[model samples]
Target chain A: MFDLEAVSAQWLGFTTEKMTAKYPVEHEPIRRHCQMVGNTNPLYLEPGYVEKTPCPPTAIPIFALPGRLPPDPKPRTTVLDIGLPVMGQGFTNMSREQEYLKPVYVGDHLAMQMRIVKLYQKPTRLDPDSLWIVTEDLITNQDDELVCLVRNTLLNFRTDEEWSATGVTKP
Target chain B: MSRQRYWEMVEVGEGMPEYQLEVTPTLIADQVSGSQDYNLMHHDRAFAQSQGAPDMYLNTGFIEAMLCRLVTDWMGDSGTLKKLGIQMRRFNTFGDKLTIKGKVTHKEMNAGEHLVYCDVWVESDREGVTVPGKATISLPSNQLNH
Candidate 1:
């Protein structure tokens, strides 16, 4: 058994500073990303497609690049860093919720910020020592408008018994 | 890609286009390169087996991309993807053919924009539903009906 308090105490309320990065919504990156997934959306492939579309060019790659996150810089704290306290040997991404607020057009710059919102432990019959780490990202276009709000929930499975000397039992 | 789908054109309960993709080593490698994800499991079979996995499997980042592809392919170029939510339930390893499907669950006019909602899911023979997702798409109105 692991010390629940020790693990919980180390990770709860642990947050990261807002880490920002500049991502340009360029045509090549957009096209390549779509191609990799075997997507044949002409709006993403054809020439002058953005201008020809019924919607504004801004909608061309709206909410694109998929959930290609965690590759980004975490600034002060890396939420996915295995080095973090109470970090587990196993990781499972349980869920993700994203809201696209504004359109991100090609040539527009994106100001992205990510931080760990909450960290807590939950008792499970399968793994009582698992920790749930939830992180959120706020992405804004160059115009300073919020483009998207993203939330990612992940489960960290830790089974090390070395840290249980405190005799913490599962709730 | 030739035809531009407009808001007035689509009907509620419409079935979006089905996307089928076979997960191959080269494709996964391409994704690893495209997403800048250098995880060994996505590329190294030996390392993955060493970690107790049956074989090298797909990464979460690629799944996200697949979800995006499912939504975007349905929305077309003119359609604005407003939201995407996905829950990864199973691991999609090599040689698995994923069939991504979705249907229009709801549609409404919000702030002069036609917002369409969809319930999306990814299935394979190995796993009935490897991933399930939801998405919101804003479409261009042809008649300008508010």
Candidate 2:
């Protein structure tokens, strides 16, 4: 059995290196990205509209990467390891919250920092044998302001017996 | 656009107007670019499949933003979104048709303000599975004095 308390304790005082990167708004990659998301709001694309509002729709809120963080052994996953399960396995992305304190233009540079906030465990009521582990991440900007917070829950069921024991029911 | 206050007439269990959106790679890419998310799983199909994603990429935070926008758009400027929670049950891939729907589930008076709880989700066009989530909004009540 995993030590719920011990694992929770590990999450405490758990910190990762502060990552800093600046993304120029004028980059073609940025423009292409804006076009891909289907945001027809001229504020993001039209340079003329940008001259008026000066703030692109792709700015601020979208610039905050929720789960962008360096890998830590404490959490036991790589950048690739993050996301929902493959086939038949159950995973739930609990929530993502963001707030924009300032505007970002096409040429503005955004600085980012990421850290682990918490880790906890819960049991599946449907399948007594299944345990669900959750991890929380906080991503902020250079000004030390919070941009977004993401909480992801991973369900670990090693076997069909465990899955059945956990009373796995499809929605 | 003039903002309208939603507090005048809203009841618990009232369904808000639905908004239909089409999700495409271009759309997903725009959101990803705006958000500065370079995760290949969201933009690159070959990478996503290598990582176990069914499709190339999916919209990240826009889903929640759209839901919040839905309420704010309906509530006009008078309502403020206080909290929003979402569960990404399945991947919303490129070129997927998404319908955002919500219903006011609960209402209460708090601290001289009218608070409404709404359950919302993005349903896949092919599969009806609702990405489960709920949001809370604080609106100026006509009866309540600020």
User: Tens digits of per-residue lDDT for model 2 on B1-146?
Assistant: 22566565787778877868776645764665545555555666765554345775454455665675566556654466666677766777777788888898888888876888888878878767547787777788766654
Q: Over 4 Å off in model 2, which ranges? A: A1-9, A16-94, A97-171, B144-146
**Model 2 chain B poorest ten-residue lDDT run:** B32-41
Write out fnat for all predictions, comma-separated: 0.46, 0.24
State TM-scores per candidate: 0.77, 0.62
RMSD values for the candidates in order, in angstroms, are 5.4, 7.4
lDDT of 1 by residue, A83-166 (tens): 456444555567888776766666666655666677777754325666777877676666778777878887766432422533
Which residues of candidate 1, in runs, are more than 4 Å off? A1-15, A46-77, A80-83, A123-126, A159-171, B49-52
DockQ of each: 0.42, 0.22
